[model samples]
Structures are given as structure tokens and as C-alpha cells.
Target: MSDHSNNNNSWHLSIVERKFLLLWCDFIIVFGAIFLAVILRSTISMDLFLQRGYFGIIFLYTSLTVAIFYIIDLYNIFLIDFWTSIVPRIFIGVALTSLLVIVSSFFLEFLALPRKSIVFMSVVIILGMMLTRYYLMIVKRYPLNIMVLGSGFAALKMIEDIKKSGSAYFHIIGIYDDDDRKHGKEVMEIPIRGGIESFAADIKELRPQMVVVSFEKEIKETWTDILLQCARSNVQVSSAVDIYCKLFGKVPSDHIDALWLLSGIQLIRKPYFIFKRFCDIIFSLIGLFIMLLIFPFVFVIMKITSPGPIFFSQVRVGLNGSHFRIHKFRTMVVDAEKRTGAVWATKGDNRITAFGKFMRKVRIDELPQCWNILKGDMSIVGPRPERPEFVDMLKERITFYDERHLVKPGLTGWAQVLYPYGNTIEDATEKLHYDLFYIRNMSVFMDMKIILKTIATVIGGRGGM
Candidate 1:
């Protein structure tokens, strides 16, 4: 949810839902501008843009551009201030989309649109997108104005997330608690206001569209009565836990109690796993094809660089806590771990050869992982497989660490693509949060997104080690 929202764009909906609306809004604007350009240039009616002949090209362009935007992090809703940072990325994405179209035109005979039209369409899309983005930014049209009701740890975490999100569509009025010490205090610079003594009056005066309750312990029975009364008067009452899940894709680590872990049991969807395996087979073949093509070049480089085997295999933890040998183009010195046994890769580790660094940077080292996918040892998208040495330590030190193995391991995954290279227990814990989020929200669309994003991450030469 930090990166994307579901399709619903309602204000009362969580952070992800509203951002999903914003994403679609972005798609529409970009596509609309292209349609507008075609109409103005070719003198066609608006409906004509959707005609069979025109629609194919229109869909391709819009979809590619939007995908490029996502790859460049245009939809990272958690960024503190994105507008100032997004212009160059937007420019690069626009250029890349145009270049793709131009390149494809040589092979696809139907793509022979006039150069002027293409140029004009790009101009219109860029202008329209910019104008629309700025307009949305300047607008104060949030559908949800929520008042957080609590002064406990949960309340503080909720406040912290909301404050960090920089969401234009969500307004947090203030936190309310009954503790006398916090009645007039400020948390995150927002007034704590009055406690239970003035809760009803404050709600009435602020007229929040929703109330989120995150008290660590149950509030007074009288306060619950008042909350129910406020709900009856048209104010929505929502759980802080649910709101937290909506804002962040993962459950809050601190709030992962018994019920939360038990609730995750329902996420094991058999049908989805079947479909996911199908994807793994298809994509793994494609990856193997690419790997085969580059085999000779990599082989020669490996032979010339380090005195080691071209491929290396390591035992990694996989589904249901099973272990499998994972294959990768060797990117470390021969017997690199002989002295240290099993140690984490360090930043700029001297054990890595020049070719190894290049291979890791561009992710060519992972090409052999396609074999793992083909062999049913991993998925195309899921949690990254870890070594038994690390897994055992992680399980002992990190909460819910074993849950990642409940699903199939992956070649490139949510954790692999989203998080930086993790070399310590703390880093592993952060990656686990992202891994858990992926497991809970596993879907066809989400998998495709992770794959697409992995492509971008690889191309950017930046990703976890």
C-alpha cells in the first residue's frame, strides 16, 4: 500500500485505495492527452480514438508510459515530498516510452504514425500530466478527514505513518486520549487536544469523517458508548490496525499479536498458486533464453577474470521450510567463504572480482536462477530464498521470520526489488516486513508489478546483493 493502492479511490478507503485512484487518474490523463492529440491532428471525433484501429496503439502507448512511471518510483506515496523529485524521472520515462514506440515502429507495420503526431502527442501528454499533477497537488479535495482516538503506542505509530505519508487526500485532525498528562500535549506537533473528558465535544466540533481507535488497552466503557453514539451520528468508526494495514502494505510489527498471525492462514490460495506456477514456467523459459544468449560472453569473461567455476550453487531455504540448491553465475572469488565459512556479503567486499561486480550490478549473476524456477524450486515472484545459516539466525532473532517460507521462494521478489541489500539481522528484519506484505497481498497484478519493477531495478543497476 505504500507503493500502490487498490482500484477503489474513495476517501474513506485506506491510503492504498485513494492512491489507486490517483494512479488511474494519471493513466487517464496521459492517455487522454494522446487521444486529444490524435483528434486534433487527424481531425477525428473523440469516440474515434477508441475505434479498433486507433485503440490498439493508444493502449500500448498509455500502458507502457504508466509502467515506466511506476518503474521510476512515481507512485511511491510514502515519499515526503515527491513533486520536487519526480520531474527528471518523469522526463526519462516519457523519453523511454517514446523511444520504445519509435523502435517498435520498424517491426510493426501498423505503427507508422506521422512523426509530427508522435511528437505532438508526447508534448500533450507531458503537459497534460504536469498540469493535472500540479492541479491535484494544489487541490484540498480529500474524501477522508480522520480523527485518531488514542494516546498509546499504537496511536503514536499510526500518527507517525500518516505524518510520513504526505498524503494529499488524507487529513488527520488530531489525537484524542483520556490521559491527563497528554490532554494538552502535542504528538508529532499535532495537538493531543483534550482526553476522554472532551472527546465527544471535540468530535462534534472537528466533524471528522472517520475515527480510528488505537488504544493499547480498552478505553472506558463510557467512551465506547460515546464512540458508538458518534458513529450513529454519521461518523465512521474504524480500527487502527485496519487503517495501519491500509496505509502500509504490511501489518505493523509491534501489533502482530496472536489473532493477526492466525488471520494470515487464509492467505494460502491454491488457485492463485497454480496460476503463479504457470507464470514461473513461462517467464523462466524467457529468462533461460536470455541467459543462453549471453552464456558465451559471460563464460569467456569468467574464464579471463577469476579462477573459479562459471556457476555456483548454494543450499537455500524454500517452501514449507524445504531446502534446495540455488544456482547462480559465480560472483565471488573461488572458495571465497573458505576462511569465514558462511558470512554475509559486505559492501564493496574485496572477495568480489571485477566481473563479479558487473554481473551482480546488472543481475546477470541471477540468470541461472531461472533453472530453479523451471525446476519448481522457486517462483517468479515471492520472497527471496535465504541460506539455512541466515534463516536459522533470522528465525531466532526476528519475529515471524519462518512465515516467509510458507510461500515459494523467488528469483526476484517484493523484498528483493523494494529493499536494499541486507547484510545484517536488522536489515533482514526490514526485508521480512516487505516479504510479509507480499505474502498477504499476493495476486496476479501484484506479481506482474514486482516483475516489471525488478526489470527496472536491474536496469538501474541497483538492488539487494
Candidate 2:
């Protein structure tokens, strides 16, 4: 119903734009909930609420609620098919926020604080979120007619992701490729629009808000010139990988090149590395203290059930091609690799004892790796450390395998949380895509997400070897 065809400003919605839009919505909802909570507590409650000098309490509660939602990834809401995705995030977001509030209430005692009012506010917030999202999906929506400029598999992948996610948000009008063989072929029900030799001309003709360049092979210089001209006129031009990452949450590993690495990964700064190291030590200490409290029980169960040492240690490759010994609570037979040296654990691996399986499922087995984090061989979050034997094999088989070692390895990593436990080279290849995405997008926000996901996975007893 809305046409952005001729708008030079473009109708492109980047991932950053979506995140900011949701953030603003959440801010309003949180403040509104706070205001309602105060009103619901009494007819006119400024006197009562301010009596205890708890003005800062509202600020604290609202800030913590929003922060928890972010930490639990309530903001990854997609407007397309918003119902199927947004509902659960809203429920989880509000529930987790409520839990945090209840836990904090123990430390901060507010006189005359109405517990019913707090609960009511959380419900209203959830209802407000649903309304906000429904309004977004149902009203004032515009779809961008976008075109892709290639016939390669990368281009095909982008088209598939868009069709799945971009419904009512992005409309793919056509695809253009120079290959005469594909001149008439259709992708995802969208017709191939032939060569983009005059990409600028095509822009004027079709009025596609964006042009995604998805050439699988080397880009011809002439096509590059045409794309630059289109961009010069303020037409939104992006790469297939850019769109792919937005849709799939991972980079296109097959289409990766040295140039992408240079552009995407140079954002890693010295302070980030320094601060990340500090977090690893601090969190590891907290983890180790908890592990100690539970250690005697786990140690006895591990030994009695498996008849192995309480702790398991193995040689793992770490940063800069160096190696370190990684420690974990024993989750396998003492000589798991004695017969079949350096083999990965499979789903029904006979070497895993009853206790070992449980440990792996709950991730109690990996707890000892906090020592590795303390010793600087690993970060709190990064690429999962692999055994040198597997690293050597994978490096020979996979592209850019050693690049993961550019940073310290992690006890739990991006790949581990996003992907299931990988037992085969194929699975590793898939995980590598996630790993590359993490490395490229490495930041405090990404690390927090990985931590949250890992917690969820462990709680659900998922991805055990």
C-alpha cells in the first residue's frame, strides 16, 4: 500500500535500524509501566512514593528491566512474522525481568512497596509489548523492492533468506546476472533480469530501493563501476554477505575472502581485549567458587561411576598457534582415546559413563576450564578451543581454520551456543560459519548474548556429547 519506489533516501531497513526502533519502543513501554505501577499503587502516590526517597527506585527498576530484556535477547524481535517470534521473547523478557526484580528486592527494601503493583506492571509491560509489535506489523508498513545482481549460489542463498524473513518488509522484484545461460531462469519465483551492465539504467527503470551485489566469482571491473555509479546516486547497494548475515545470523563461509576479513574484523580494539581478559578472570573466579561448592559431590560421582580420575586434562590448541592443557571434570572413560586416538565423541559414544553424560548435558564437565580462563589460555567468550590433533586435521580440510586462533580460545563460545555439539567435519564446517560471524562481530554485546544462550542450553540439557 505504501510506495517508496522513487525515494532517493531509500526504503532499506538495516539491522541497526531495527534494533534502535525496538529499543525506543522498549524504553517507552518501561517508563509507561513504571508510571502505571505508581498510579495503581494509590490514587495519587507522589507523596507516598517520594516519602521514602525511593524516586531513584523507579529509575533503577526501569533500567534493570530494560537491561535484562537486552541480556535475554528480547530485542532480536523481527517485524516480519512478528507473532511467531516476538511472543516468546516478550514472555521470557518479562518473566526474567520480574525474577530480577524479586531477587533485588531482598537487598533493597522499599517501604510500602506494593508487590501486587509490581506484578501488575510486568503484565502490563508484556501486553504493551504485544500491542507495540502488532501495531508495527499491521500498520504504517512499507516494503522495499530490492534486486540482486548475480546468479550465483550466494545470491540464491540471499534470495531464500529474504523470502523467508522479508515478507511484507522486503519485496524482491528481480535478479540480474551476466550469465546468458541464466538469462531466463527464475530464483525463488522471481525472474532473472539478465545482465547488470547498465545497473544505473536498471535503477532508473525498476526503482528498486536496494541493489545487492552477489557475484560468486570475481567481480568484473565494468560491473563494479556501474554499482559505484548507482551508489553515487544514493541507491542502497549492499553485498550478498551483508544481507545473508542480517537474515541467517552467520556469514557466508563459502563466499568469504581476505577482503571481508580485513573490513569486518579490524574493529577489535586493544581496550576490548584488555577488558575482555579482565572479565574472564573475574567471572572465572566466581564460577570456580561455585564449582568448588559442588565439586565434592561431582568428583565422587564421577570417580564412583567412571572409575577415572576426578579431573580430565587434554592438549588443546590456543591463541597464536600455541597449545595449552585444558581441564574439565571427567566426562569420559580415562582412556577414551587409547584405542582410537584423537577421535571426537559421538552422540552415543560408549566411552561416556552415566555420570559423564549427565555432566556433559548440564555442562558441569566444562566447569574446570575456568582454571584455563584464569591462566589466560582462554577467554570467557571466543571460539571454542579444539584439540591440536583435530585442529591440524580441520586446518587441512577447512578454509581459514587457523584464523580462529587470532584470539584466545573460550570455555564456552559463540559456535557452541548457536550450533549443537559437532562430532563430524561437516558439523565443524557449519560451526565455523558461526565462529567467523562471532569473530567479525566480536564485542561486549555479542559476548553477553553467547553467555545467555549457553546458560539456556545448559538449563535445557541440550547439545551433550
Candidate 3:
């Protein structure tokens, strides 16, 4: 057997595994830095450190730092550049973490650290994290060789997307297809190696770590047999759909077929939905409480600034294509949409009152949606619901568009957090990719991640209309 047949696992680390490793390393670095700071500040032994609420303080600091880093997107290792991206974000995360820790220490005396120790600890953390990131960059410099078994448009698009990702993790070594004319040609500078007839032989010669099957048409049994043989030989064989989803964290709306959609829908356990609904109710109640506290002030401001209704309600397509009235703080003139008739909101629309812009930026406009959640018309996290008019058009145009309605729409969602506000059909199509991915991978942890990201977005004032 060849060396390629020695192991079932690929030699390169997966993206998820890499992120997990980085998180663990960050935890260790943070704990070590705090330990060093405490030791330098005093002559206390390890026993004394343990007696003084060491574990509790360390856990608090480490968890908060990790969360801040995540919210700031530090764990997106593939997208990070050490100097421009990683360093500045690290500073922001550390500062935020330190501020939070100090504020928390007021309520919990044992959590307090000496000022000098905090400074020393921050310095150590910055340096340690930077070094760790630099090491990872160096190790991942060599890209994984990928042999693609198709030369279709999907293959070309996949290659283009991979390049656009700016990730040095995957390199397309060659593309193969059964078409004779394409065999001698090149797509995106990658040569078409040969026909599918020679796939088994080419695998031996090229010895690619992974083979991506991108054929849009029905693959013949012979081709399937060869792919199976590759799998049996410990070579990684994956569909372009799987690779695309893994790479971009979104489904390829253009490339996927109906069968793929049908089979790919994850069979979430009944317990997950029960738990999700429970959380939705609890969080919605908390959200509604906050809304009540702020409602009086918001009402006064709105009445003075603009003569619109305090609240706006619109019909939206919700779970299983059900229509429901979604509520939000009125952020525009009372008759803003009277002329347009349900058109998408544009950038800097004159219909929006001056204070409305501020409200949207801080996401006060969305606070009213807690009522929708409370009514079970929405979830705390899921796909953002679309207007029935827009949904009708999108369902006609975009592939798998209606699938987003399989779950209740949400006030904050994976698509809403990751993608900007959509005002065009193209933008809606792009967001659908993210929405489908969320629907397929819905879980409590996923919902929590989206909520954290949504909080970061609101704090940064990046929320768009």
C-alpha cells in the first residue's frame, strides 16, 4: 500500500479543529499570564494562590477574554492577517476584557487584581497571543493540494471563491473532466489534467490529499466506483457542496440541487426544538422588560422628532409559510412606505427621521420584536423573516428560498448578524445562502453564538436599515 493509504484522516488540520486548538491555546496563555502576574506581584506560593480564589478568578478572566476575542472575530484564523487584523483586534479585545473584569470585580471582591498586575498581565497576554498566531500562520503556509474532478462552472466558481477567501489552506492542483475538448484547456490557470477515464491512474500520480467531486450531472457508476476506491484507499473524497459549505459557512444556492436540499436538511432532535422554545420564551420576556423600561424615553423622542406612530406592524412570512404581524419601533415617517408600496429600504432614505437613524444604529427599533417572539411568531435566533411580497418574489427567483420558513423567523439571526441589510434581489439571494445554512445547522449553541455576534454588532453600531 502507498503512504497515502496509511491513515484515514487527512494530514492537514480541519478548520473547526484549528479553531478549537486556538481556543484551547488562548485559554492556557491567559491562565499562564495571570499566574505570572500574581507571582511577580507577590511572594505567595502556589498553595497561597489556590487559597485566594485563584481558580475562580482565572476562570472568570479566561472565559471573558475568550468571549471578547470571539465576538471580535479573532478565532477566524483563516481570515486574519497577523499585523493588520490580529494585532489591532487583540488590543480591542484585551481592553474590553479588562474593563469588564474591573466592573465585575466591584461586585465580587476576590476577582480584583492589583493595577500593576493587570498592566503586566495585559502585556504578557498581547505578546503571547501574537506569538501563538504567528506560529499558526507559519505552520499553515503550505496549502493542502486538492484535485477537483470536474471542469464545470461550479468547479470554476468554487476555485474562484477559494481564492477570494484569501486562505492559504487549500490549493487547487488540477481539474479533471470527461469532456475531450476541455481536457487540454485551462480554467482559471489550472490545467484540465485529463478525462474521468484516467481518474484512478491520475490519483496515483498526483496523490492529492483531497479530491473534490463537482460534477453537476448524475455521476456514472464507474466514476462512483473510482471515488469509492479512493475512499477505501484512505484518500479524502468530498462533494463540492460539502467543501463550499465548510469554506464559506453558507450553502451555494446556485450549485445545489433539490435532492441535495432534501437530504441535507438536518434532522434536529425534538428535544432541541423544545429547549430552543423554552429559551426563546425566557429571553423574549427579558427583552420585553428592557423594552418597557426604554419605551417611555423612546416614545418621547419619537413624538418630538417625527409625527409617526410609535410602533410599526407589517405582515411577514413566518414559520411554514404562515403570515404574521411583525412589530418594530417606527423608525420612519408614518406614511413612509405609502408611495413605494412595500419596497426595500434604501441607504439614507429621506423617509427616515433623523432620530430614526440613531435608533436603527443602536437597534432600538428591533426591541419591539420581543412581542412577536412572545407571541410565538418568531424565535430568539433563526432566519430573519421577510415581507410576504418579498418572500413571494424571492421564492420564485432564489433556489431553496422558502426553506428558511421551515423554522420561525427571528429578531436576530445568523444571516442578520453575518450579512448586512439587504435592499436588492441580489442581496436577498446572497443572504438566503446564510439562512439555509442556519436552518440546516440550528442548535442552542449556534443560537448563542449568533446572539453574541448580534450584541457585538449592536455595540459597534453597525446595524443597517
What Cα-based lDDT does every candidate model obtain?
0.75, 0.76, 0.78
Give a tens-digit lDDT track for model 2, residues 1-465. Answer: 123342333444544565678777887887777667665655555787678666677677778787877775666533356664567668877887767666776786542347787788788899888887666555644455577888777778777776665466666767888888887777668777678654556677666656788777789998888888777766678888876776566777878786786677787787888889889989999989989999989877766777858988989999999999999888777888888888888779888988888888888888899999999988989898998989999999999888888788887887888787768889998888888888888888678768877887888879467
Estimate, for each residue in 179-198, the C-alpha lDDT of model 1 and write its tens digit.
78877777787677777767
What RMSD does each model have against the real structure?
6.8, 5.3, 6.2
Clash totals, every prediction: 2, 0, 0
Residue runs of model 2 more than 4 Å from their true location after superposition? 1-31, 42-113, 135-144, 161-170, 196-209, 216-235
Give candidate 3 regions above 4 Å deviation: 1-133, 138-140, 196-198
The predicted structure with the larger TM-score, 2 or 3, is 2
Worst 10 residues of 1 by lDDT: 1-10
**For residues 1-465, what per-residue lDDT tens digits would candidate 3 score against the true structure?**
112332233335544556788899889888887667656766667787788877777787788789878877788744534676578778877787668767876885544668987888888888888888776674634445678998656667778888776665566767888778878777776778787766777777656667888886778787898888877766678888777776677888788776777665657788998998899899999999999999999989989989758999889999999999989998889888777888888887998889889999999899889889988999989888888988898889987898888889998888888788869888998899998888777776678768877888989989866
